[model samples]
Target chain A: MAINKNSNGYIIIYTVVMVVIVGALLAFLATSLKGKQDANVLNEQKVSIMKAFGEADANFDGVVTMGRINGGEFTVVEKADQQAVFELLGNRKALGEATDNLPIFQMEKDGVVKYVLPIVGKGLWGDIWGYVSLQQTEDNIIITGIVMDHAGETPGLGAEIATAKVQDMFAGKALYDATGAFAVRMQKGGAKNEHQVDAITGGTKTCDGVNAMLETSIGKYESFLRGAEAEVEADTAAAEECTCGECCEEEIVEPINEEE
Target chain B: MKLSKNFTNPLAANNPVIVQILGICSALAVTVKLEPALVMGLSVTFVTAFSNLVMSLLRNGLPSRIRIIVQLVVIATLVIVVDQFLRAYMYDVSKQLSVYVGLIITNCIVMGRVEAFALGNKPWDSFVDGVANGLGYAFILVLVAFFREFFGSGSLLGFKILGDWYTPNALMLFPPMALIIIGCIIWVHRSINKDLQEK
Candidate 1:
């Protein structure tokens, strides 16, 4: 018996069967791939953090230390529990009520210690975020490198923030001004001082977002930054105060060579 | 001989982008860079080939009243699966292509092949036609993307070819430039193939 191809009953049955088969296929694929996708995302975060630290292809296993700021105190996170820190960054939002725990990563290379902070903020269209690498000098903290990304900023305009040209400008720029305010920003006309960088030509709003992102996110680590800065200053001051101490003893040997 | 004609016809004489003027939207959108455009091309090829094969195999049993809906369901499912696979395996390219992979469901080439050729042909013949049409579209996409990426960003496939002294043409990075390049391709293609020109 030939089936009636145009009958309503056949259409309904065909539709139901087709829908069920397609749905099951897609559901099965999504479930099977979820683990791999999650791993990719986590690896991407780790790579971004490494890139921001200016160490591409660097091993992340034992080199970087993960931590969080809780109750105005910084605490190191164990390696096993570090997955939660990455998840926290993935779910971060702009202007969400400041959470008790703020994620931070620390890495040391060539005797210089760098702090990598995960920051989230709003751009013209959607969420903007990045890892900012900061180093402490004798008096202040300066950005060493940064790697930014956006959910949906306009390409070539606001999205320029993600480009190396823009991010490279953050390097050597101090996070604090002489007045000691969180003064780093994207200057509109052109940056005139160390605290600013030139903003994208047509990306004023997104630059403003970056400015806010840097201020609020980095500002949350003020206590940690101040402590780090004080330690550096104290070390230099103590070195200068020594006349016959370890630092001066080395200098004295150098002076004797000059005299000879 | 018939299969060979089916395969070769779409490559140039009945090209999907230039001759048929189909799939211009994505051609413009993804052609700003070579990498994403190549991925888009391959993804479209995958969707069109499989969709054609499936539709052709099911053509006899498919009810005439719900043909379009069935085609859509098939195309949508294929596109989603491709998207999931991309996210899992090629995360960076998946991020770059972003929504265009999902938008393959709306690409006319996939549906057009299934409707115009697949439903009436043998599965093997339909599959060849699908691949040819997809590649025909891919050929134009890669050609346009080469010029765009080279001039627009002074690079090819993310590698900088021009030195610092060379300034990139900003206009080439936009969608309008893709259109202009495609228009130029059509002009050159028609000049060579006289019969394709409208009287």
Candidate 2:
């Protein structure tokens, strides 16, 4: 007898077989490519960090993950040395979960050690994130380099945040003033000082996202930087106190401001 | 000559976008950039051809009641595989293309061919028809993207052709303008093919 192609049993069997096969294949493909996709994200982050650290034309080489630091106004940890991506969590001071740990990448250029901080926040449509690198100055943290990128920003409008043209506006913009307030921003109209950059022609919302991300991400690093500054001062103090063998003393320096 | 007709008919007389107006949504979305338009066109070409071949191979066994589901499963699997391969190998392009690649599963053109041509034709012939229809769809998509990208973006394949002095027309980048362009193409196509005009 000729088989009834429309039989219920036949339809069910065909569906089950097809679903299992398709499900397995897609699962296998996603799992197999997960490693490569993770690597790509890491490499892209590296490029952004590197670009933020040196001249756009600089031939700077090498990228080191350095380590992760858990920081906020209330807590301080130095050189935590956590290396796993799964274990690493950098909260966008404004959006990330309260328990997230911040990841930092470090690179050296022209004898200057630059620390790169990755910032993530919202764009008009989706997530916008970037790397902001700071050069430790004698007194404060100076914004040396920045690279901004987005997930679903309008290609010609908000998406301009990712382009070198927009990111270049961030070069030399200081995240903190002489008194150390997070003052750097992506602002509209004409910029009067080093803290501002002109917003994209049609990307005002995205610019706002970039500004907010910097504020939250950079503010979280305030204490850590202050610690570094005190460490530098302590080094100076120790050297001066060690004049000859008669007097040698290590001065106690407050690592961070514990009061609000 | 008879075999060639299957390939040539869709390019002009039986065009998918202009004549049938089946896949206009993608034609509008992907045409904003020539680079994406080219990639989307090729991807659709692959989906259409391969899905048609597979459906035709199983046509005799396809349960009449469950044919649509079977066709959808086949088309969806193909689209996912293509999307994954793209993400792994052509990540930037894949990102730009984004959800549209998955939307190919819903692109009526793929479904239309499976139901219309593949359901009835020999496997080889169905494959040819699918490719022919894809090229037909692509021809219109690339045409729309060319005008949109050139006038709307002042560029071709992401390369700047217009001088710095040129101001891009934002209207061309908008989706409605794509409809207008497709409308004009349909008008021109119908004008040339007098037989296509309704009495």
Candidate 3:
């Protein structure tokens, strides 16, 4: 007796066989490639963050925790990225709210400690995020650089925000103005000052997204920034104040010869 | 020579994309870059050939009521496997192709061949037809991508073909431009095939 190919039983059996085969194939392939894919993703994150910080080749010593801007300012919840590091970027879930623990990337260059924070926000289509490094010298703190990327944005339009030229606009821009407000803005038409960067011309929604993302995400770390600045200032002042009366005597040693 | 028409007809006169105008969505999407277009073309060609083969083999057993469902399942599985393979091996190209690779399951070329030629034909004949249709689609996809990437991006694949003085046309990069380019190809094809013209 020949099997009936068009019977309901045959079709049902065929469907089950096909689904199981495809599912098994997909699962096996995905599982096998998961390690490589995760490595690729992790490498990409490192490259992008480093590029954003204007130091693509800078050796990432390791992840470091920045003391809260005011030692209890906002909580930066760890475990954000399944890694025990400072990827302190706020998303839709943590927006306008304090994070449990904000992760700051610390890099020591030329005796100065540079702090890089994570940025995460919503774009027109999907998630937009990047790393922004803050450089503090003897006096003030400024954005050393920023690098942003998006999961999905219109190519050549909204996606232009991820280009080197766009990210370069954030370098050396002050994190806050005289009023101590996080003042970085993606100004449409043209940006007039250091705190502003021109928005992508036909990519208004994405630019608006970057603007709000930076504003609020950076705003969430406001106290931390202020606290870091004050700490630096106090450090500089304390070293220069010379307030001890007991050891006021100065030693008059001969100046060392130069170029010996 | 007599058997060649099955493999050659779709290249021009019986083309799946231009003459029949069936699978235009994927054509518009993956044709923006030459590399992706090539990848997509290969992907389509592979899926069409394999799906056609599988459909022909199962055509006798398939219930008439659920033939379309069977065809879809075959095409979808083939496309997903291809997508996964691409992600694993061609990671960069996979990233660029993104959703368009998954969208291949919707490309009418695969299903169109199964419905038109595969069901009643021998596996070998159906495979030939599938390859021909796949080539036909690839032909149009490459042509569209050639013009789109060259004019729109001033480059082919990743190499710069045009001088810096040549400013790329932003419009050509748009999805509508793919349609326009396809329209132009159709116009040219029709001009050569006067029989295709309407009275």
Candidate 4:
């Protein structure tokens, strides 16, 4: 039983059959794994947000409150509506010119409250995005932590932004200088002030992208930040005034009671 | 005894990386860190072994004219499957490996083995040969990665091994360092093996 192995008909049929089988197998695997893969991405987003808050292991649901800021009005999203925050952040760039209504996550730890802001921007190669958490102090806002990730930056050069050593420089840096300008940036050469951090040596374009991203992304929430700041100051002032008045009244009442 | 030779020969005598010079591209690219190198090794092993076995099983089919094309389709399918699985279960490593995982489709070792051995061999024997050659390539990758991570970053598998005072050799972090290390390994390998040296 001898059949020509190199016949055109046989080759064509073999190619078609092989292509069909392989295509079917790959499609089936991709569809079945889509759920698990998407879950992984969602969990990674949560972890990045948590990392930006400096509580890498903390539970996301228990510690954070989600909100959105639009036209200086803040709307809190309930626990069930948390997916809205992620969706908005994912669509931050798509909203482009209409950058309002950006998502914000609030968490308090060790009596200090911080706001986690999702930032998106373009690098030299592709989209670069991350979570940046700013801590509220008595006078100014300081960066508590940051977690950056890139889509496609040159490895060991522009991609260094994802490394902790680079991200650590942003911590404790003030968003605005004493004059109240949005001064935080990745300074070229070397950083000499509190508002600036050293830019990646070889990643100038990517660093520039980061600088612009920080300014623009953080700028979108300026009104919300100011409003929150004022509220905190008023609350503290009221508490101080109450303590002072209570002390004076207690002393006066005590002396009157003694005379009686 | 012949079955065992198919498994053991590529581990040293017919080493795919140092001897056959196959898959040197990925060997150089992913060996910057020990973790990725190890993962890359395991990944290549999976692709090669499966492709070899599959090709060998199909070798008897009457289609010599399109065997190369068939081999390519099989290898590509396996690589994609590996990439998808990595993205699903090991997202971090997947990100770290980045484009190298996809590039595994082009690694010459998979096709070389399928063409050179698998086409004329039994399925189980071809599979063993594929695994052996894969480990051979991985052995060199891990070796290069060890020196690179140890000296370039003062770390092993992401754990810092050197003290703060120990400044790392920045040269080792670059790609050229991997080549130099490979050269050194080849030199050492030839010195011991003796038979690998040219006349």
* lDDT, candidates in the order shown: 0.87, 0.77, 0.76, 0.84
Report the CAPRI category for model 4. Answer: medium
Task: Give every collision pair in model 1.
Answer: none
Question: What is every candidate's alpha-carbon RMSD to the true fold?
Answer: 6.6, 4.8, 7.1, 7.6
lDDT of 2 at A63: 39
Query: Residue A170 of candidate 3: its Cα lDDT?
Result: 81
Q: Determine which window of 10 residues in candidate 4 chain A has minimal summed lDDT.
A: A251-260
Candidate 2 residue lDDT tens string, A1-260: 98877788888888888889889988998899877876665555556666777645544333343645565322323334332432333233443533345566666656777888778789898888878888776545678778887767766678778877777777777666645567787778757677778886667898898888888777666667676765665566567665653332233354422222
Error of 4 at A91 (Å): 6.7
Q: For model 1, how does the per-residue alpha-carbon lDDT over B128-154 read when each residue is reduced to its tens digit?
A: 999999899999999999999899888
Q: Please, what are the lDDT tens digits per residue for candidate 1 over residues A1-260?
A: 98999999999999999999999999999999999999999998999999999997897878998988876577999978887777777776532446667788899888999999888898998888889999998777999999999876755568789889899999999887766778899999999887999998768899999999899888888877776676576566667686556764444333111211
Task: State the fnat of model 3.
Answer: 0.38
State the DockQ, from 0 to 1, for candidate 2.
0.54
Residue pairs whose backbone atoms clash in candidate 2: A89-A101
Order of models, best lDDT first: 1, 4, 2, 3
Candidate 4 - chain A - TM: 0.80
User: For model 3, what is the alpha-carbon lDDT of residue A91?
Assistant: 45
Q: Each model's TM-score? A: 0.87, 0.83, 0.83, 0.86
Which CAPRI quality tier does the interface of model 2 achieve?
A: medium
TM-score of 3: 0.83
CA lDDT, candidate 2, residue B47: 96
Candidate 1 docking class: medium
Q: Which model, 3 or 4, shows the larger TM-score?
A: 4
lDDT of 3 by residue, B36-131 (tens): 889989999999999999999987777787889879888988898888778777877787777888888888888889998899998988998888
| Candidate that scores best on TM-score | 1
